[model samples]
Structure formats: structure tokens, C-alpha cells
Target: MAKKKFIVSALAGILVLGGIGVAAPRHAAAEPVSGGEITYGTQTDPVNWNPHQNNQANAFLYLRNIFDTLLEKTENGDFVPSLAESYSVSDDGTVYTFRLRDGVTFHDGEKLDAAAVKLNLDKANETPYSIYAFPNYDSATVVDDRTVEVRLKKPDASFLDSIAYIGWGIISPKSLTEHLNDLPSGGQNLAGTGPFRISSYQKGAQVVLESFDDYNWAPETKAHQGKAYLDKVTYRFLAEPSSRVGALPAQVDVIEGISALDVSKFKDRDGFVYLSNDANGDTFKLSLNAFLSPLDDVRVRQALRDGFDLDALVKSLYRGEIRRAWSHTSPVSPFYDKSLEGAWGNNVENANKLLDEAGWTERDSEGFRVKDGKRLSVRVLYPTQLDREQRSTLLQGISQQLKQNIGLEFIVDLTPSSTYLKEVASGAVHIYPSTWLHSDVRKSLNGLSNGGALATDNKADPSIQPLKDLAAEALATSDNAQRIKIFHELQRKAVIDDVTYIPLLVQAYQIAASNKVNGLGFINQIGSPEGVYDVWVAK
Candidate 1:
């Protein structure tokens, strides 16, 4: 499980009120003047806001403030009850019983009970592409109006962490029934039992949310319980980074996806602060199409892994803001093993030796390696965005370096965001840049090992048996210490064994805020932005 650390004291003393310094107000006693609108900017436009349909982080951040989950993570990285006041796991770790809180109502004014909870879980399980599908759940039983029990097929220690994911947010039973047929596709209606409710939404444009005054079951980590301090939250779509950053100084209260180059520009500004951290959120990596002709050979894959340099790529492109990753697990991930340093730096001699052993000595007049009338080349595909452009340029540079030293030809193929996933899923591309959204290594590794067509590049199947076994063992063990040990071992095997994916960088979570904004804090886990319920702006 990924641990979430909170810095309460870090933001307790920092006061920013309307471009002037103010004394830190007393905790819980200082009632903020509620009834102001906060404008936030994001790079990507959300496809859907409904929890049952959308899985993007930006969409979740908006939905989390409106929909409550059965449980939530604290600053100290512990699981606490949210909709359910308390919960207990069976001795075998397969059965979970939740004791629901009383007097809770959904934004739609429907009562939230055990039946609602069961209905929501059942709907989530039935969804074909849901995150819940990965857990192999059996069924949810309604013990009574305020109590429910969930049974899993196997003992999964990471069940709580998985629940902390964005796709696991609980929805109202009424909404599920109304949109039952559209559940598999996408639903436009937004219904949740969270602190805020959707007042209005414009597809591919903006979403407006109003605080729910009747909300009272806030977790202990929450600073305010009755109502959110802000009257409304307006999330606007700004796909370009330059425009988003420019909007910050113009009084945009909050924004996300700030580039590293702009961090120092706003660091010392008064009344302005940015919350940044190396959360175990996403891992950026390169996926190799093992099913391709030349790549089908293990020695060829090993040679490709040994031929590239990651440190230079990080320094030149990421400006040292992100950490270089050796395994699929990020530094903050519980599964990360410091001992395994993976294939790093340039090793032309070893790469040549591996290729030679694989019987690829023949070379064409152009000086590219050839085997059985086929040229040794690969086409790398990536999203045509600024961040992706930087990564692609770095890959091109690495490929040029490898060609000069080891006689391999590489091509770059940039694709639009809309068609990237479909292209990858159809196996139309070979090399591509991809990311694993979940914090747990098991979930990330399982996607690659399951033999299903990847969202990008379905042409090759990379055998992930080693990773699958590791995930199974980690989830089966009940002991926390033992689970960590097994996870660490799994990461080691992933790095040293030269798996299908090469972990490259761990990008830090960056958010740009205005001088008037307050109450924003760091959540050192996946889907950190969901804690926006605690955020407020001075009136």
C-alpha cells in the first residue's frame, strides 16, 4: 500500500489573505466568510464528471469534492471512515463489514444507506473497464440500513489503497438506477454525497460546484465539517500551460500541472504559494513491443535496454525536477527497492555483444543492422503535447546516440491525444511513452502482464509472469511487514530482469495558486487533488 504523509504544521502558520499578511487564525474557530467563487485551470478537458464513467485525475479531483467515498486517507497515511463511520476486516482478510454513518443524504436528497452502498458497489463491479474489476470482488451484502459487508475472492492487503483510487468513489443508488443502461458507456449526470454538489456543467468547458450545507460527516482530517468555505468552485479547461500559468497572476485562485521551469518565478511572491511534492502518483515509462519481428528476441530487447541513457534525458528535458526511476515503482512507492539500480548509462560494447549473439551481424549500405532482409528499426509514438514533445526529443537523441554506437535505426511517430490510445490498442505502433496512474505496483504491473491489448501499442505481448506472481504473493500475505518485503523483491526482479517496460522518470505534482487562496495541502498518494474539499479562499 502507498503511504500518504500530511504536513499539517507546514501550512498552519502560513497566512495569505488578499495580498497582505495576516495573523494565523485559530483552528476550527475562525469561520470563513463563505460565498466566493474560485476559478481553477487544467490542461486536459474532462471527458466526463460522473464517478462511474470517468477515471482521469482531473475529473476525480472535481468529483471527489461532490461524491463521498466509503473511506478516505489521512495525512499520516492511515485509512479512516468517511461515509461509513467504521469498518472491520475478517481474520482471513476476505470479508469487510462497514458501519455507515447516520443522517447522511446524497446531493440528490436521497437517503444513503447500506442498500445504496451495495447498489453502488454492484454497479462498479459490473462496469467492464472499472478499477474495481482488478480486485476480483465476489459480492456486497446489505446487512441492514446502515451496515454492509463486502467479500473478495482473495485476501488483498492493498484493498484499502485500491479503494482510495479515483474510480472507487461511491455514487447514489438513485443515480445508478436512472443511468443503468449508460453505466457501461459514460454518464453525464453527477450525483455524490460529498461536501459539494454540481450546480452546472458545460461539456468540454467548465464545471461549477456549490457547497452542500447539510454535509456533516467530515473525517477528522478535515478542518471544516458543516459546509465548504467557498460558495462555489469553477473548474475551467485551459489545455495550454502558458495560458494556465498566465491566468494565475490574473487572479485565478488555483491551477494544476505547472511546469518546473515556472516554479522559481513564483516561489517568493507574497500572498502566493504552490503545493508541490514527489507523490507516488504516476510513473512515466517506455513500452517495448516484444511481439515485433526483431524485438521478439530476448537478446534484442536486452540490447535496447542497455543502449540508452536516462540521466541525460532527465537533466536535459525535465531540468532535474523529476526523479529518475529504476523500476516501475516511484521513490515514494512502498514497493520501491533502492538496491536494484536497473539498466542505466550507455553500454555500447555490451549492446553490440548481445545483438551479435542474436545473429544480427549483417548490415545494410545505410549502416543499419539487418536480419533476414528486415532492417533493425522501431517507430516510437507519443502524444503531441509540450511535455510529450520534450520526451520525444530526448528519445530521438538517445536513438541517434545508439545508432552511432550500436547500428540501430529508430523513428519517431507523434500522434494526437484523441487517437493515441486507440492506435496503441490496435497495435499500430511499436515504441511509445505511457504512464501507470495507480500508486500500487500490483495494479500497474498487472495491466502489462494480463495479455490484454495495451491502451497503446497492442502489437506485442510482454510476458509479465514474474510481476504477476509477485503481485499475487504481496496481496495474499496478511502481515504488513511481509507484504512490504515481497513487494520489494518484486520490484527488484522487475528492474534486474529487464522487463517489458523501462521506468524513466517520476514527475512531481505541481499546482499554481494565487495570493488569495488558502487551505490547500499536500496528499502524498495517488489522486492527491481530491482533497480540494479542505481548500478555501479569503473573502
Candidate 2:
């Protein structure tokens, strides 16, 4: 199968704002023999097939198949047209006008027009689910049957970034109006203009998707775009890592959540195709709760930031599978600041000086720092999973190092995901490891210190206001050059100066498919697999 490249052109996108018509997408006709099924295995079941209400990684595995975003994000981070033929932004950047493509239909046989776009956006904005990260979008107004005008409160240059976001994909206006703010259950209400529609879904079991015969609108980033080649695609929820890896070449055509050992085992092998992409949403970091006693002091937080050998942490946890990373965004993000590397990187001697200067001078018999009858110890709450042993091993090394250098005691408390939120909300646990997955890095950076963890996280700190102001200015401006500057400066100030959060490494999402599968692809900024839409088995 050849690569599918059916997106609207950038030059045409520019010309579109000036009232020039954009060219049609180049579709690749599939071979006459199109009837086949793609059965794949994933780690988790879709929380809900609805994207607006869900934010899990595996959820997209289902949502993406049933829905299509207005634009398609490429591997290189460019946004091209999908549901929308071409869209143009107002000069002030507050208004976004989209020209709908002709002949596109949703799963329910409803035509995707300006009304559909308005309905989906309006519904998504009102969903009570807390994880939804669409920008502060105001409204979507229908200019004409084929055109829609979306207005934002302010200029968000990253607005185009989330256009291809999961759940932000346009839905059928009729289905939404019928449901009217009440979420339909068990994926029953799922409707989109994607190439496939939900055939059958049993919660926590299997989801079957059949290709939409009338489906034709696909962003140019895909390969062979008339409709998905496979007649049906079955996504089986295989939770165990061993089961996921074992079924790879035979039982399942594609599998994810493969263990690190299996990734190496199949990397050079001929029968398996391993695909790894960096996730943009979150970073693996020890969030220093600024409200915590010792961490409340900026000097102490800076000391801890300087003390930890982050490269060691990365090596221990990921075992060389991923690299040490900096910044709130992935390296591939447009606003990513590459210069932030090693600028706030780990150190040992500087850490001791800061701690000593902060008046934690007394050392106890156990060689741990003591001040005012308090031990220099911190508790870190983390989820107990496959990496618990690895994290324990790394913490042991850190314990030895911190004890010897700064006389600090580091305690790691493993918790389950069920109780994880309870512990975090309790505010008793200040330090913990968590990932923040998102599409736009601008949103990521601004809210990085505002919520969750902070070393000395005072949102109203006059000391940190300049950095926050710079970020606020960065978000308002649509200029990439200015964004790059502001993002870099924000990284330097927050991580290095404020010691807010230490970005250990960029998270890697692994997808392994059997040799039989072809044209498995990815979308969104984080690079998760788009769907089995373009995949076909060689029969």
C-alpha cells in the first residue's frame, strides 16, 4: 500500500483567506478487492467512544476510527484539511472561517455542513468531563450552508493545533441535537464523518468498526484515501502485556503496550513492525508541591532540582528506550524550546550549597538534614505498576546520593490509580509523578505551574509574575518567532529559576504490528496511531 496524501495545501490555505478557491484533495483509489477485516489488540478498552468526554490514550484508538477532525496533523506537525476542505484565519486571528467540502456525510447519513461544525463545538465546550483541553473557544457561527465562522476570545496561535485534536472532530448535527447535552451511553451515540462507523461495541470487550462506503473526505496525510481498505476492523481489549505481545504475529494483526523486552526482541526481526512516537501531552517528572514544608522554600526546591541526576533517572526508568528531555512540550512541537536543554539540568554540589544557605545546617545521627526538629525528607506518591521496581531501584540510588550530598531523605509511596486522585486531592502528598498529555504546548506551559505540583508554586508571586506575563503575551501573539522566544524564556524561568517541575524525559508511545498489517498511521500532535482506517492485510 502506498502512502495516502490527500490534504489541502498550505499555499491554498493562504489563498483561501483572500477568497480564492482551494484545490481538491488527491484521492488514491483502492484495489478492487476491498473486503477484509483488521483485528488488533490494545491495552485498554475505550472509556467511552465519545472523544469530548474522554482523554485516555487508547480511547483515541476507537474515537479516531469513528470521527474525523477538521484538519489532519502530519508526522512533521503540520495541520492539513480533512472534514474541512480549506480554512482561513482572520488577520487579527480571532476569527477562523472554514469552507466545507462537498459530498461529505456522517455515519448517520447526515451531510456535514456548517451546522455540524457548530453543533460539535458547542456540545464539546459544555461537556462536564474535566479532562477536555480545547482552548477557550467562544462560539461557532454559520456564515452560510457551506461556511462556518469560529470565534475565539483572543488570538490563540495554537488554535489550529487542536483542530485535529481527538473529540474536536466534527459530529453529526442531527445526532447531537437529538441527544441535547445528555451523553449517550456505551458508544451508542458515537457519530462522525470518519471513514469508519461503529458496527458493534461491548464495553470492556471488543469494538467492531465497518468502513463507511460513502466516506471520502480524508486529510491528505493518509494513504489510499477513497475509503479504508479493510471492510472491517476489530479492536480487542487485551490488557495483559504478555497476551498483547504473544498474539502479535498470529492472533492479532497489531498490538500495543508491548513490554520493553519485546520491543527489543522484535525490533530487528522481520516478522514484526515496531513503531514508536513521542507523546506531547505529558512529562515524567517529580512534581514538587510548593505548599509542602521544606519545598515551600524556593532555595530548597532549587536545591532539589539541581541535586537529582535526571539522566540517571531516565536511564533507570526507561532503560535507554527514551532520552532526557526539557521543556513542557515535546521536541517536535512548534513552540518547543530546544535551548532549554542542560540549562536547568541536574547537579549535586550546587544543591548542597542552596540547602545549606537555606539554614538546613544541622545533620542528624542518620546523616539526614534536620532543621527545627524536622527531617529533610519528602514523600512521593506514584502509581504502582510495571515500573514500580525500576522506580524503586532509581529512588534507592537517589536516596544514597541525597543522603551523602544534602542529607535528605526521599520516600516513595506507591499507590493505585483508584486511590491516586484521592491522595493528590488530600493535599497531604506534595510530590508525585504524573504525566500531562496535551496537543498545544502553549496551554501546557501556562498551566504547568498553575495546577497539580509546584516547588514554590505561588501563582500570585510577584517574583514569578514576569515569567507568567511573558507566557501570557506569548499566548496572545500569533507570531511563531515570538512564540519560540517566549517558550524558551518560560522554560528557563519555570524549570531553572523557579524549579517548578523537572522534565525527566519525553514519553514514548509504542505500537507494534504484525508483518501482515500495512499502512498503520498516526495523527494528533502526540503521534498516537490515527486508526486502522488505512490498514489492510495482505491476503
Candidate 3:
């Protein structure tokens, strides 16, 4: 019954996941005790504090408590009001009206109003970080003190969904002028309207967030009216999965997901409990970075993508726990296009022809192709913390496929967590793999799949321009039926024509905590660690 999906109404402004509302549970209903600091162990440290720029799935471990979105999305894809009291869209769908809560305030003394919404929306649309936020947005108009009328260039049905899920919760009007783009790690210097305040941060080590005493505007679904029970929430970055699991029951109160190999052992452990949910987002993908040379050549990117085997890797490493992804969007998403089931397959003959046609006709004594004095060599880089057998074997297979069949040298490089992003962003690495944790179908329009100058997958390929336009078309058209057509058109281009982004497998986030921890659950946004405000010490 939970799997059934009904057609979404284009004019409807509300989101109802599984046809029900997830009432934000209260502390009194949960195990009751005064308070205790929750030390959370995470896989990696966030590089940026700016929500628009921070793409890591674990970034929410800190930011969720510090910020609140305008609306909440249930795990089943329903939308509920959050920061904004209620919202509605015009018949044409170009204008959206959101009514603000009566007395909401940022951590700073600034008041929350329509002006704050407009300022943040305007800033997000301009920044490269806000790739999916206000995607087709034109301008924001403050209708009144509590009302905001957002005007879009075209009609869009999912614009509210984008707002309901942006990591950049409306910032303090004060912080906009002061902390704009200068925010450091954990966003300790930034101000938000959530139930927690960033108290301290030690850069790559840990971030401490103290509860906001004056916070009472928690969404109506929330069980508590004001002030969180826990006094402090500390997120400690432990890159090693084993290190995080070891910290349990003592050093840390909760640990984010265990290795697949260790899942059974932790399942029945008396002092601990396991929690997991299948993510409705992008799975692990070997981003075919076309910006780098050799790979900058579209045929080479397509050849490499076609030659590798992703199903074998998923079957070998995941053991049926996760399935190989076909489209850039998750299978769980409504926009996912399944016709591309076998669009990319093992094709050594096609791979060889592509290289030969690209004028890599000369072979060195080592049997490697060379054109214009440059060897057909590519480097693969991945974070050390992400080095699981599944990833390790996948890289090895990618290397073997390119080297043995086509004489392309695939050098595998291990990058430390601290400098991984810098190395990937330096444009030196040809192949890098990561996961996208967005619930919105617009995941294809951001980062690697964006296919723009800022996107890693772009390499002056004029073909991607049309797909980008199609993304805007799909986003702006209010009709879900029309969107399905446009979305498939974009997926067809991405999979068969471009082959720039390779979707590997669907994955889940496992949140585990001490048995004493209570009221930890999903938030209405993407990523892990949901509503921390409801969590409290058990008596």
C-alpha cells in the first residue's frame, strides 16, 4: 500500500507523502529526561558552511539543527508547511504566494519576513551553489510584510518542492550583508531560524551547536512548541567507518551507517539500534569529467562510459543490497526514466572505433594510444574514506576495461579526505565518483550533470545546451504529464546521446545510535539526521 503512487495535481501547492502527515514527534511523548549532549560521528567533514555550496550528504548532520526550510517533505513525497505557514500557486503557476509565520526570528535579532525570503532567493539564484533552487526564477516581490510573491519566467509545478528542500534556509537579513560567502566550516558564524545555534567549530575536527532558547516557531507538526530538549549537538568528523562504529556507546551517541559487511553484527547488538531508509536521490556515479583533457573529447567520455560494467560491480559488492541505476535520477523519483535500462552496455568494439576515429591512431611500443604527442592516459581519483570493496573493485574494473581492450591508461589515485574536493575541483582528475542526495527530480541540473561551465561533466560540448534548456522547460511547465515527457527527453540525451554522467547504483543511508537515544528521525529535507530538536536523553 505504501508503494502506490497517485498522479500529482498540477495546481496543488501541498505535498502529502504516503497520503499522510508526519507529525514532528514531541519530547514528552518520547523518553523523557532533562538533556545530554549528542555527539554524532560522521563519515567526512564538510568543506563549506554555505548550504548552497555544501553538497555532501552528511552536511545536514550540522546544518539541519541550524536552519529550517519553508516546507517539509515526507519520506513518501508529501509536502507540509514548515517555516512558511501556508502556500498557494496561481492558475498560470508563474506566481507563488507564501505566508510567513507570525513571529519567527533568526539567531541574530533580525525578524523573519517577506524581505528575508526575497533576499535569500535572489542571492541563491545568482550563486553557482544554488543550482536547483529557484531554477527558473525571475524575480521575488514582497506582496506585504508577511506575504511573498515569487514570479517565475514560466509556469512551474515543482518550484515549491525546490523551496521546501533547499539547504539554504532563509538567512538572517543581518547575516546577508555581513556573512555573505565568507562563512567558514560548520557555519558557526552564520545565523538561521532553526532550534539550534552554532556555538563553536574546530574546522575538520568537530562542530558544536547549542539549542536556541527563544526558538518557538517550530513547524506545527513538531511535538515541542519551543526550545529543544538536548542542550548541545556535537558532530565529530571521523573519516574512517570503523572509527565511527568504534566510538559508539562511549565516545559518540550516534554513528551514521555501518559498513555493509558489519551490518549484521550491529543489527542485534543490545546497546545499539539500526535505522535505515532507501534514499530517493542519485546513487554513486563515476562522473565522466569532460572538462579534463582527452576526456574533454566527448567520444572518449562516451567510449569509457560504454566500455565499463556497472551491474557486475553492484552485484559483486552490494550483494543485492543496492541496484544498478539506469538514469541520472533515482528509480524512486517520479521523473526517473526507465526506458534507458540498457542504454549503456559493455561495448569494446564501439570503444575501439571511437578512439580510432578521434585520431588516436598511433600506438606506442607499450600498446597505448598516443595522439599529438599526448598519451591516451586518464587518472581516476576517489576519497580514501569512500574506499569500500564496492568502490575499489569498481575502479579496478574501470581501469581494466579501458586498459586491456582499448590501450587507454587508467591510473587509479587515492585522495585523502582533507584535500579531496580541492583535487577534484582542480580539473586535473578525469574520473571522480560521488553520490547525490537530493529528493527533487531536478538532480540532473546540478553539479556533474549540470553540463554547464561550472559543471564537471561539461567540456565545451554544445550538445548539452539543449538538455539544459529542456531541464528549464520541464521545471517551468506546471503539468506533471508534460514534465514526464520533457524529463524523458533530457534523460534520453544524457544517457544515449551524451553519456556524460553514469548512474551506478541506488544506495541507502543508515542512521544508528545508542539505544538510549530517542526521537531521532527524518526531516522534511534531503540528506541524513532529520529532526534533532525532538531528540532527548532517555530516563
lDDT of each: 0.65, 0.68, 0.69
Q: What is the TM-score of each candidate against the true structure?
A: 0.85, 0.84, 0.82
Candidate 2 lDDT, tens digit per residue, 1-539? 12122345542221111111111111122343467887889877755556776666656767787888887665545568887888777666677788879898878878888888887877777746424555668999999998888888986656666676775767777667775344435454667888888888877678888998987777776776788888998888887778878887688788766656567867767777777766666565667677668777878878876777778766766776677778655665555667777677467788888898999999899999889988998887776542321445565666666777678888877776558767777667768766655566555666553533543335566655666677667667545566667767766665777666767667666778776667665554565665777777766
Candidate 2 local Cα displacement, residue 397, angstroms:
6.4
Per residue, candidate 3 scores C-alpha lDDT tens digits across 3-46 of: 11222222232222111222222212344565777898877667
Top-lDDT structure, candidate number: 3
Instruction: Count clashing residue pairs per candidate.
Output: 5, 11, 7
For TM-score, the strongest prediction is: 1
Question: Candidates sorted by TM-score, descending order?
Answer: 1, 2, 3
lDDT of 1 by residue, 2-93 (tens): 21222221111111000111111211213455667788886665655556566555455676687777876654456667787877666566
Error of 3 at 233 (Å): 1.8
When sorted by lDDT, best at the front, the candidate numbers are 3, 2, 1
Candidate 2 residue spans exceeding 4 A from truth:
1-7, 10-33, 127-130, 133-136, 174-185, 344-346, 362-368, 383-409, 413-429, 448-463
> Per-residue error at 538 for model 3, in Å?
2.2
